[model samples]
Target: MRLALAQLEIESAAVEDNRERAEAAVAEAADRGADLVALPEIFNVGYFAFDAYQRAAEPVEGPTLSRIADAAREHGIGVLAGSIVEDLAETESVETPADEGLANTSVLFDRDGRRLAVYRKHHLFGYESAEARMLVPGESLGVAEFEGATVGMTTCYDLRFPELYRDIAAEGADLILVPSAWPYPRVEHWQLLPRARAVENQLFVAAINGSGEFDDAELLGRSTVYDPWGTTLAGTGDDPDLVVTDVDLDRVAAVREEFPAWRDRRL
Candidate 1:
């Protein structure tokens, strides 16, 4: 499968402009024959733009996702519409009544614009940030099939937790998509974690991060794709870029069979 990672430059609270840029990136990726296109975390509203979270938050079927679905159908390619600030109160899908909370959510759409899976971030960041206090944590893992690959979804802070990736892999995921808004001063950790996940889980990991500054933080936009063997297939620098690369889904099986480490695991 050919995957496109869009490292978009996000501006704080500029929802419309960000959506337009994301759509254009999807179109460009599709034109280049990308089977799937993924965007960075909170591409519409900057992650550190905490003040805009409530105002920009919307339901699962809000205009943000609708526009992304249109792009997916228009290009005939699957899309991972990164993470969004979801207003739980505005949504009709969930049963419980959390009348005053929001969740950080990621959505997946098929080539024909069919909704595949939705992943709300389980691990909310709190390192000098207010995500934990502002958003309600998600309760489940996300996995789905697309173009002969079992894809999984996780957000930025989720990368720090290997058990989460293992759980998703247990649910039959071979390709993991991570939408992140990771900031600077920790680029080392950013680079190390994804590769570690790919190698340990024996699955492909594609990490898509954003570029640009927010308040007092700046994103380290080194979006990367790793094969099962922890080999870097494609990566971008600390800039806004569209990194496209081909991946062999069958390699996952091949690597597992050749290494056989997963079978040796014990309690």
Candidate 2:
């Protein structure tokens, strides 16, 4: 299938503007005959716009994901709407309507606008401060079959966990998708980790990251795609551009057939 990754800038809690841009990018991808489009994580609110989470968080059925769903249906293309500040359903005890289940959630919409899956970030990044304190960690790993490939879902910090990818692969995922807001000073890790995962797991790894500078941090935008043989099929630097590429599922079979490493694994 032909896949396009939209790596762009977020407007720091500006939902409408980011939605418009995301719509435009989806349209562009559709015009190019893409089967699926993957967007950057938290494009509505900048990654470092931590202060705006409370004000900008929306429910799963809210306008943010609904907009992407509408766009996906309109274009007759699949969409991997990046992470959004999710406002969960109202609880019994909490009086404040504002205090909903706030999670960093990623939603996938099929060509018909039906939601395929909603994967929240299982691993929260709290290295410097406390992302876990603010957001709720996900309970389940996401997996789905789309465009003839088994797709696995993950967020920014989940890249550090190899077990997640291994579990996805064991569950029959040939391509693992990571929607991230990974920052700089550790750009080397960003580059190395995904490729290493691809090499080690013998599967395709696709990372879609944000570009441009946030409030106090700058995301290293190197949205990329790797083949099953651990070769760079397509990649971009720290710039906001759509990285589009076509990957055949047959390649995975061919590589595994030739190497036969997975069959010999004792673990």
Note the Cα lDDT for every prediction shown.
Answer: 0.92, 0.84
- Identify the candidate with maximal TM-score: 1
Where is model 2 more than 4 Å wrong at Cα?
Answer: 90-100
TM-score of each: 0.97, 0.94
Model 1 scores what on Cα lDDT? 0.92
With a 3 Å backbone cut-off (N, CA, C), the pairs that clash in candidate 2 are: none
lDDT of 2: 0.84
User: What tens-digit string does per-residue lDDT give for candidate 1 at 96-130?
Assistant: 23665999988999999888988889999999999
Q: Name the regions of candidate 1 deviating beyond 4 angstroms.
A: 94-100
lDDT string for model 2 (1-267, tens) is: 998999977667777888888999899999999999998888888777888888888877788888999999999999998788887653232122244567888888899888887788888888874578898777777888786788888888898999888888899888888888888889889888899888878888899998878667788899999888779999999888899998887787778889988777888
Q: Which ten contiguous residues of candidate 2 have the minimum total lDDT?
A: 90-99
